[model samples]
Target: MSARSEPNEPGARAPQSRTGGGGAGARKDPGWWGAPPAGKGGGGAGVPEQKAAGDPRTPKRLPPGGQRGGPPWMGAAMPAEKSMNFGPSARRLLGRLRPHRLQLVTIITLGVSSVAAAVVGPKILGRATDIIFTGVIGHQLPAGSTLDQAVAGARAAGNDNLADMLARMDVVPGVGIDFDALGRVLLLALGLYLAASLLSWWQGWLLNGVVQRTVLRLRADVEDKLNRLPLPYFDRQPRGELLSRVTNDIDNISQTLSQTLSQLLTSVLTVVGVLAMMFWISPVLALVALVAVPLSVIVTRLIAKRSQRRFIAQWRHTGELNGQIEEAYTGHELVKVFGRQREVEAAFAAKNEELFQASFGAQFISGIIMPAMMFVGNLSYVAIAVVGGLRVASGTMSLGDVQAFIQYSRQFTQPLTQVASMANLLQSGVASAERVFAVLDAEEQTPDRVASARVDGRVEFEHVSFRYKPDKPLIDDLSLVAEPGHTVAIVGPTGAGKTTLVNLIMRFYELDAGRITLDRQDISTMTRTELRGRIGMVLQDTWLFGGTIRDNIAYGRPGAGEEEILAAARATFVDRFVRSLPDGYDTVINEEGSNVSAGEKQLITIARAFLAEPSLLILDEATSSVDTRTEVLLQRAMAALRSDRTSFVIAHRLSTIRDADLILMMEHGRIVEQGTHEELLAAGGAYHDLYHSQFTAAASVDAEPEPAAR
Candidate 1:
């Protein structure tokens, strides 16, 4: 589904806010619209001030040149990026061809045949040279052309040998020409080129089919790998960075296969075939050309090795810039609030400049290979011409052989330049392939065997210890139990590990120690499908995909009928505002339901949860964003839904969870107190202090006049 956005086109007026019944239609600013770029800091208070790349300490900062840097977002707590082994990664990429062995074998067969046919061109052209030469040798009569003039001049100078050499013709008075041999040689050369071209076309057609199939499987594997990987893997890496690996990296590999792979095969064949023809024609000339071969190799190797780093840097900068765009564009509103638009743009420009420099260095450095190869080739050509001319003067070599040797030399040297360019492309392709393989080889979550008996709403966390990282243990040796059909409200200050506890219950993160069981079964023992199927979560974010309201509501149970969906909506109080809209339940929601108010989107999520009717319900700050009046309505609706299920509520607004059956007052990573609201208020502990602090603060804010700026 396409993301719905308001028209910011030129001349378009800004949208007006609807201030209607119960003030529910009043416009509200969405605090943050997107996740931050994933990096080491985890989007905490300070983002390490966006350092430049190259400095290792600043994990996600762009250093001065923006050559290469870590993921900019700290939203995902992904593991630190690791360097890859090129050889193994390339081997793994080649192994993908194992599945399409037949097609590959055919393409290679066609390539070999095409090259063999192509090789005949230089040799056959040389044969045509011999024919033309023999036709002209030792016979003179056709006098008008340069060769005729040369012979006339030689005869005038009284040089019989020079005259015979210049006029090497064997035409009889009546028969005149040996057109038969000349025609056959030229026609044969044309036929060979035509055949070679046709064979290459067939090979390319087959190779394209093979490339598409291989890339298709590679893309599928990357997608499947995402599902198998643990949530932690996604935490520290930006989605954009991973997207670059799956799409841009894989696409690079496919392109190389289509372009470089065939060129590589043809270059090797052309080089070998040309050398054979050269040696057959003249060994001494062949030796002169061979000397340039090593020079070309050394020059190409030196430049390619240096260029490889720049190519890697080019891709690295690309991933970083992609992450920057995603974060900045998606979270445009947050940047506006902070007034960091200029800063964001500056960071982007710096990263873009780095990417440009890296690409320039990679391309410019490798680009020199062709010119360098051509220079060496020309030197060899000069040496061959000089040596062949000397041999011809000594009567040891014919003009035709010398001419053929020069042609063969050009063919041999041409592929070396082609090979040089392909080598550079191959290096870039291999770098991309390694990134793709890195994603494929990432650690996967252990497979679960679903025990298909039954699960009650009873949940128990026994001495469970867990942490995002070893340095800071978020939850430690915690024990809790919620019997079937009970309301467990977890109340705490921000960063009190409230959401972390919810994550543990849902098994989104594995426990560091101990066990969490549902009924008598360990939650980890069941497949995530079976376990999560019974649990319903409505986070504060209230995410909504781009679709009709009906589609979004029915996402809880995709095949649910209209009546059931409407019933769920009515039960959750979503039907109240939904009916006020002209389109009713069919009203289109934008990405994240931006078209609707925050409270409205929240109610829709409640309706979805109502439809699911899960055995366990988790609400993490489900009502924190709503007004006091709307909160009352939602609380009433939630009470009805919680009638026959075990529900866990994490709330910052103490008033909302006041009536919860049991309130666990938490601080740090443990529950400091647990009781009913009234019981806690009477006890005068952390819960009492927190309840007073929230209400007292609200009361003071209401009484105060205009406040001064911080």
Candidate 2:
């Protein structure tokens, strides 16, 4: 079959060349949306007129300049544009969270309270320590007082007497009393610790409810969109990739929103509170702690730059790996029959290895941020201790203040590191969001007119043409008609657009050029649901969803009565096989009918179609994979079902199409000849050639006398 030229329509164009050798530009052609420049002579005949000559309305192409190919710091294979802006995704995600604003506010409040309790707990303990060691131990009060009395007196005395006594060598209160203010300090620390723990637990509970519910809703919406999306959208995307977006990508988002959000809040609050307390205690020490900020920031920035790229790579490779594994498993039989196990394994292994490398690199880079921050934190702590100790000794700062400053320094560093770690999780979440949004933002299929009503199964194709890609036209200006209550069998060589013809009839794809009508109404103008409701199709590849036999039979006609399902099954001869099984109608089918034989799957599908009771029935190689006995049974069943309904059948077995009212022979996307079986045989054209190719050998064998009764 010769490839047809891209129809020079207003929007037809070869995709633009990629910008760089690899990375984003290599992965996706930047000019994918740009239309090709129109050629001379208004494009050859059969082309749409608007695109025939260069339309003045088309935008002029800009010359490439500045960071168009690759970044200066990156290798030639990595494009500068590989770094996607997160602004749009962030806005979209944040918008989704608006509905749960109250939940988010509560979560953040709990997180901040938790950080406050954690921070203040140590300060309360330090105060109690100073009261016990200085006020109670210095003997400024009576020597032999009870523990409670001593603690009360020490609390009343305050820090002045202690400082005076230490300066003048005078005695302070409660020197001989045991269990002084230290007990109070311990109690206060315990209370704060408990408060922190409780707040954290509550935060987790609330965040979990919000995140889980949100994710569930989001995933459900995505699934709903999948159902509504045009069937042609699926043709260009892998099932595995789509599955990952729904499952893995959404899960990643949940993790990010739930955990990272809490961490982010806690870290920011802790850092702010700690820095304020540190400056109040000792500005010198606070400065020392603040120095670590720039270093930490630099390290985090570098790691984030590298990690983001790695994350993108990881997700891409993961999608590829999933696609390969899914393809291999789905086509296992074909692989085995062709002895391609080793080749398939090699391809899978290669994709898996790529995924592993990308994942490792991404994780390794992100993993460095925490330890790098910690190193800087440790240095800052040492500097704070040295500077504060000297200041206290030189009488510029009090010992209690110096101690508080040291505690605050640690607090500040802790949160900074925590925030850094949380950033990694946030980035990963953003990466997943990018993928999910890509699906959400894809162009929806054009909607048809709403005025078109239900049809009575009369269909006509007028100069219809279609191409999956601009460079490959599978159907070319093909025209045909199917009247009500007529069986039109389509006979064609492989790749002769047989299946595509049925797809058009179903309006799964929009025609590139031409009009298809049903009962004098354009199919495009009809609602997809209403259009498909009147039609039933049994594909060569039968798919059975996970359910019981009865459930599958009544799938298309939910709420159907048991008698109706049974009658439909009987009509397709599925009842006989189903009855042989232990559970009869209760027999279960796995995904895609993996547990059933091909003939049984086909029969079940036929039963499903029969139950739907459509006005138009399409059988695409319905009995191609069945044995002779099964084929004969199916043939009879199909013949019985065809009466008084418009039907389209695509078949290779000559015996199946013998009684068809009209037969159209197709070759290379065009109808070469058309007539009854007898007329085609008499014409000795393409149809005759195909029939003879199959039946000629059988006829010769029959005429050879069957090996003389051996």
Candidate 3:
């Protein structure tokens, strides 16, 4: 029963032209690959210009400071460079943290409390210093000498500066050092310092959790968005670049938040608290320190503006470089087979250089802020010290007050420096957020209908019109029908729309004009899950995930049992070879499935389709990889499979589809002929020419003379 009489010899395949566009190798719509127009989230401000036209080998140009556009595989449509949305993206990034507002407010409160306590500690310690100085001066004076008398004695001794200094010092005439008061002040300062440290630590711990949770939600949203995107969107994007957005870009955002959030809050609060203390202690010195504020702001603004652009370039180049690396690694065998290793290496080097330059520019520019801030801070420090000394000498300020004011000045400048550094992280994080947001904003597939209907294996395409572009019509008014339990065979040359037809039936895309129905129920009325649920498909390219063979087979039917899996495998002859292997069905297949032969891989797919028990079946060049003997067995199994289900088979080989109930000959997305095999040959039409051409070309190749033995 497995050996039916073979029909005419199979046809020799024509050479296929390679193209970068089209889905399933069925169309030649070149416009689909064109670069997206400007202002559509595509190319804009900072992108590098394209290389020479029509030369895929030519490398793209680099922008000033070495930023390269995306790799060619991204089709020039992926956003290489554009106007930055720093303010908007940063706001949106903060919006992602809205759900954790309570935690954030708590963290801010703790930051304020901690900074306030630390700010007071310096003043308390300064008071202790004042107490010790006064005790020393008071101990040296005569027991009954008043402050006026002490000043007179100093003036009489011709030490005018000492008299002026003594006038500023508040010394009781006979009192020595107050160890008790100094100890109390020191203990109070220590307690304040300890409390500030504890509060800051607690705030940091809470901020870490809040930031991690926010990032977790962001990552989840991106994952969901990716799933909702249309197939055409994926076709337009490079896999490596998209992965970078999902993984690398999100990771960068997380790092930025973790490094910046708590520190920025604490620094800002510290600045406010210290500035208040500075003014209270000495308005004159506080005003002097304020002089540096304007200078610091101007320097930070100028550098951050330039570095923001660089950060955007840095992350974009990172994504593009990742894309190129992925493409090279994925096709390494092809590169080796064609001996294009040098070319691949050259492309990688070019992109790596771009990344290096971008990273260098961003880091170098942002790094300048820290040193500039330090210089400004030092200038302010000198001004504050000189003014404080004069105030103390004039008796307008106590020595302790001047000392406290000096400490406040340093505290103030340090936080300003911290804020400036945090700007670097903020810019980098926002740039990454913009990239992640772009994915979330992509156009999604049409929403599925809430209502659904069960399928009965009757499929009809009615007045269907569709195209990948506005001017390029791939399928125009195409119509077909297949009755229940019938085997429909579709044969065509490359780009003749054989695969597109099947894809249409699966609703991988929507029709532009008419409708497709299953058992008289409009397919568009059903949810995609419900519509695709009852259909089983096997394509020419076998896809096996990294799992055991048994698991792969079970993928077709999620809850399929051991008995069902075994029966399906046995029916397709998969069990015969699988049992011969040492581990049998438990043998693990690697990600690429290189451990299995092409023919064996094809059989496993057939077995998977068998296990699905679908009401509708599609096989696109399903038996092309198997040997003649194995092909015969698969045809027999396919026949039994189609006995009670509607089946659509797309094939190049004529011999395998001889027994089909109906044969459709398609060209240019239209069916040119349709009939039974014998009927078509009798008519001597397009089908006859196609059938005989295969037999004749194969026969001629077999008849060629072999080289004679010497």
Candidate 4:
């Protein structure tokens, strides 16, 4: 169905109604409509006015069908501030629960059994009371006489009437109780209790298993989805919010489902079973007990509706607060440099307060449900006592029946309150489910049809036009070629689309208007795994896994032997550093190589790349972060690895790429200059200008004499 036709659609396009200010057929007010004043032709008016038929002073609006400032749907949807609720969130939650049908059945069964066992206890006690009072005492009374009269008759006659009556009763003579029958009933109750306990335990065990595994699977699914999601998805969502969906929200589901599913099932079953038994005991008392059910339900529903909205708001604010904190911490260096610590802290405090308010409101409403349910339960208990007592006193009902009814009444109300409490947890689970499903439902990245073949490392970019967003094209109709065994150095100012160029080569983003090929085969036709495996990269920002140095170096090929790892490290001059450490190649590195210097991290990354032994290598600012000495050593290492391989180097330092076979200087997403270093310097174009402007300054600084004389 179309979104506009959906009953609960959160967003819909509505036709705009033109108001009186300035529209077609209205007299054009120059000041109000951006048109010329009546006498002055053009002035401060908001709308353009039509000129007289032959007037030469007015300018034309445009051709008949010209492009407008924005898309037609710009004003179609309402602002997010006006949203009433998280629409479609509940429906998505239900979809997630659909897979757990069998679990649901088990939960329901255990709940029913537990509730039945609970109700049986009170009924058994009531029956025992009846047997003692009515069966034993009433049977001893003489016919057509009260207990008092019978007592008087027994006293006057003096013939053991009470003893005769007791003997006539069902009680066994010369025994304290009916051992066999009582044993059987007691054993039945015991069995019920044991079964209920086991069922409850198993229910918890299974639900926890389901919840943990489900959440684990969900997190994995989300991670996989993120790997396949279009870059645009990340562009629109905060990194921390997305992280929360996979981490915090999934945790919420695990907690709520694991803890509450069994309780909810048990409470619901108890309430139903107890009510049925109450009606069986006495219809009038049952009616009084039931009167509170609807009232409780109505109040619970009202509270739940409000609570759900508040919970959603709370979660959203929590995500926002987490995002802000993460952003502040991640950019702490910048924050400190700018002296914005107080500003960041104040912003955090504001967001935290908003989260606090939302959480307070949600919890407050949910908290009231339990107390309200208990109050209604108390009132029901009072009514049952007053009415049941009167019935017993008037001789219409026996004391035993009244006692049984009172016990059942308590049974009925307690579960109702329990059920109410369980609702809060269920709502939380639903809220989390909504967040999880939102990610799973997002549009996945498009698949490529390319199949890996024997690549000769010859790469081609053919008339390619690309963009991270349609409105902001990054690479515009540019083309290049890298012959096998050639090193192509891409030089550009920051944001000149240098990284984007190589990213396209790896098929991270598909071309908007052209194609990229390896060995004359379309890159898009190759499987992503096969394509990426053939390429090796050493980035400026290196990430090292938590493992031994040998493991990190040999990560690409897990089973690589000691000889291969050492060989790769030796090629990158990393072996010298490793041998110096106490543990040699066995030294453990912390996550992201926090234990090492930036230059060491770069060397490790290069070693990993060398270990891969790929046909194509991409060095993305590999020497940018290192000192001059480390850069020189890396340059020598890269020289040895570059032979017989197609390599693309994105670099800012001109000295590092002077020996490259080809150099392409980029500006504003286009290759404005291309040649060898010598050829580009001779051409005196953009590259020449950049080289003289940046490198010449550096050289002059180096040539400057120290102020030793002074």
Candidate 5:
């Protein structure tokens, strides 16, 4: 059956409109990351030019193309984001952090030292309490003079146990209490606290550096991985979500490291240190404190098990929301024109609500751990006071020891409570790390082979076959040849594998079967860099960075001279409008080229192609943006540009490609007809039908008289 014009009808991809690098996917009008940034060049009365990407704290950007943008507004429903298993994610994160082991060890050491000093202060304070009590009980020595000599006399007689006993007695038994001893013990306790504080601050400062360096390396890795990803990867994934992983997810990990790492180490150390001190003072009371441990652990486990899933869901929702925000923000103009703002807002609300719920649940559940822990801690405190009071009355334990044990018990539970509180946030960070690892673990593009010299433009597709998905073949056993310096026109309906060919030629996709060659050498054997360097393309859609007009044009040949840049701009008619602008070629084209028209963005791409000066050229609807007269001029300029280059022009307008030396009419991934325009028209096949259907319809429209004014 003869194919029909349906590329723009519905459910079809716009040509070469995927991905961008204009900083947040602003690559022409109506782009996602490459989506329409200004909303279809559309700003109806109610349509806003830009919508919020989401909360400012969570940064996101939409790339250009056909993807959706903007977050769910206030109340429409969207699916909740999904969660993943944590084991692999956690292990992957550990692997990334392993290189920083030296820094981590230093941090842990400082953390332990600081916590240990603090833990000992309570025990020292208890000695001050004992001194004060003894003075009130009249057990103080007379200026602490006599017991010192008795201790030395006992040691001289080789009675070490007697010396220890003599040291326990006051200087003059039954004299006054030791006020001087109490003051010294209290001062020592204060010193320990001050030292602990200093060490803690130093460790915090060091840990910050470690996190910064790790995340910096992580970002670099992600950027490199993006370039290595296959085109099909972008085709399937959302740019905003990927950006979330690269930016938000990494930041989450960074935040967790900075806030939770030192605290975690301190909490663990405090638990151990306090437990040891409690046992040293009185094992009976220490055992009472141990009672709270199991209860606290059981509560934390119950809450964390549930909170972990919610935290994972929360991060996932964040990425999903980011994707939607990128879509809505990029295409906000569309929402207004189509009267879908309410719908978009509803969607936004739904997504926002979902994120809110996930976050709330994770936090609320984790929040329970602290209070629950504190409750058990209070119970333990009561139990200790009761047990220690009985021991003190029985003379089995000293009053000072009981007081210190009580303090140690509180200190012990304090860290466990803190750790429980941090559990949810740490889980969130781990989940985010897992998301990042997914990108790092994705199948990278096949490494390029040996670099080759400049292409001669002789190309052949021999028995090639490919499919985006295994069940849906896009190209099958297709074969063709393009002689040096010859123009080839590829015409096909929507989904007829027209644009897919460009992807294949540029090595954006690998072939499932067969091979392509250039100048008798297989293209697959050459590095992608070598093959792409020799080829230049001006796609139907255009991409311009956030820079001056001159920068965008010279993107293909960054080292191009001013003279060369001007010549390319002049050739593409960009110089004409550029001169009209205030700054001429230096005028900045904002991201998405929102400051200019769509056609103008396309023309910039044409100028970029000219600057590249490659041996092979592919123009897919390259001149579609210009009017009749402008297109004629463009065609002339393109002809001059293609003088010695092998060119492939994929166009819907037969007139633009009438001069093509060979025309291949494609349908269902197969070439149904091949010949020059004159030959195809005479044969009255699919090509003939397409031409007449287009021209005759246009003629009839032109022939119709304008309706008479009322």
Candidate 6:
């Protein structure tokens, strides 16, 4: 049965309208990365106009992440602003590590055991100090003097304080150093330190594994999320920004876990162990050291609070700057041809300056943390030293105990300082985590039905309505049917929704109202994978990855035989050009496929589609880049491929679709006329006018007089 148009459509004079860039006419509008049109306050939006190709000022397209713009990793560090809810984001980040809980527990145990062994070393050394000091004092006294005699001698000299201190010392008068006890004490201290070192090393190794595995899982989730997200979500976001989240933000999270997680655990453990030993040796001195805790906290919080905002700006600007630089470099030729180099540079300078200021502020503020912490620690040290000396002289504490207490005081404050210093990395990492989490939390495409049906060549759009924006309708209550084994050609003005029609058929976007079916079965009920698997598409934008020509062709059907690959190549005229190259079918396409001409690339894509042998085919300006001769050959090849299969061809050049079984002339998203090419021309409607306008223009170009020989 022949397709029919809606009855409400006008017979002549198509309406003037504009949709998004989906239409060919909308090509004049700003690109996705660009501002809106001029009338909507989009002019002079700092983006330059695209210039014509081959201008002398136009620069050659540079390879992405090539020497010209450094590697992608060297782009501004992809940082994010502070998370809106830091606590929840941090918890979520930690949750990523839950899978490695056993390893984490082992690491924590090692950290605690290491701290306990390390904290004991100082106390043991203090015991050795006591032995040396007691022997020295004893050696200075008279030979064979008794304890009572020493006390009497000090009393005779009116040194009662010395008498009391001497009474507390358990040293024999005139005895020299006890080498045996000192040796044992030194050996014990060394053993304790050695144990501590070994445990800490083991802890570090385990932590590294845990962190990597967690990050690996996180990266996988991000990759899966991107695949599941709807196409419209991608359209609304910047490509560079999305890339930053995937690469840079995930990297930051990994680094944060590696550097801070272990350190934080160890530092807290050290603080607890050291504090306990300090009180055990001298509670009075422990109290004195505790005085610094509140002060240090205040200093850290003040500096961190001020720097947090700067860190947020610093990372936010970093992502923005990276995006801008990427866009500018990608379109470097366009910027140069339009003489917008200065404008591009000026814009870059502004973003660069903002990044610099933010980085400087964040660093400058956070940098003050260590010094402030040291100041507080130093004050506590001085007080402990003075009070310890007085207590030792009064015989309330031994010189060995005082020495141990001072060492414990330093250890106690040092860990607190270390914790304070981690504030910067912690904040930056959490911010990055939030960005990654945002992607994971984004809405995904609707899930497929539990059961899927097979598709044949027939497809039908039933009372379909759709829109890009809520206020502006692109395709309204449109209905069409494509029977089995027929070619349906769609032709319209640029914004007449030609591309949108094909997109809807592919289910790239969902309908606001109505249903589409395949062989009388609703397409929405099938899994996307199953639905897309049955269709082969040759797009205008040819994409050839970095691989051999043979490999690229085989991509359509992963296990396709060599003979099948060659046959498809021959059918699409790809084999001829490929054979002339040095390597024939084995010729390698570069990463950007710059090694091939535009027409050759188009042929390669067509060959790939041919290899698929799909039930349905879609060719959207697939032959537009090729010369007239090549186009004619490709049409014949496509005709063979289209035999006994449904094909949808969207084209602007009228000559290519004259033999189509069905021709639909669309205007303002409605199908105003549908008939065979001859029928449409005979009706003298919108298609009639469009067909003459293109040929008339082409005829005038061909009729121009030849120029005189120079």
lDDT, each prediction? 0.70, 0.68, 0.76, 0.66, 0.72, 0.75
Q: Which ten residues in a row have the lowest lDDT in candidate 2?
A: 25-34
Clashes of each: 22, 7, 0, 11, 42, 1
Weakest 10 consecutive residues of candidate 1 by summed lDDT: 18-27
Question: Listing every candidate in turn, what is its Cα RMSD in Å to the true structure after a full C-alpha superposition?
Answer: 12.0, 13.8, 10.8, 18.1, 10.6, 11.9
Residue 568, model 5, lDDT: 94
TM-score of 4: 0.79
Across residues 348-456, which tens digit of lDDT does each residue of candidate 4 receive? 6766788778777777787788788878878988999999987665555566678877877766666566667655566655666777777888987678675789777
TM-score per candidate? 0.83, 0.81, 0.87, 0.79, 0.84, 0.87
**What TM-score does candidate 3 reach?**
0.87
lDDT of 1 by residue, 1-710 (tens): 00011111001111111110000000111111010101111111111111111101111434456543323432222234345456776788888888888888898788778777777676677667766665555234443445567667778998866666545543332233367988998888888878887887788788778878989998998888977887656554665566666666676677667666666666677677778877887888888889999999999999888887877776676666655665565567777787777777777787679877987787778777868887998998899999988876554677777877777777677777777766556666787887787788888887887763466788888998877778876678889888899999998877677777777777667888999999978988888878887888887755676688888889887689999999999988889898899999889986535789988888888889889888889887888667789888888989988888999998877878888888998777888999899999999999999999987988999999987889
Residue lDDT tens for model 2, 1-710: 00111122112111111110011100101110011111111101121111011101111121245322211211111112235466677678767877789998998888778877877765676565456545544555566655455445544677544333344322244463235556867787888878887887788788779878888888888877766677556544554555566666776677677655555566677777777777776676777788999999999999988888787776666555554555455556777787777767766676678877887777778878878888998899889888876765454765656676667777777767766766566676787788887778777878766855756778899998898777977778888888988899988877777777787777767889999999988888888878888888886656566679898889868799999999999988899889899888998886546667888987988899889888888888888867898889888888878887899998878778999989989877889998899999999988888998897888878888545554
Residue 682 in candidate 3, Cα distance off native in Å: 2.1
| Candidate 4 wrong stretches, greater than 4 Å | 1-107, 135-195, 330-340, 699-710
lDDT of 3 at 387: 86
Q: Evaluate residue 347 in candidate 2 and report its C-alpha lDDT on the 0 to 100 scale.
A: 62
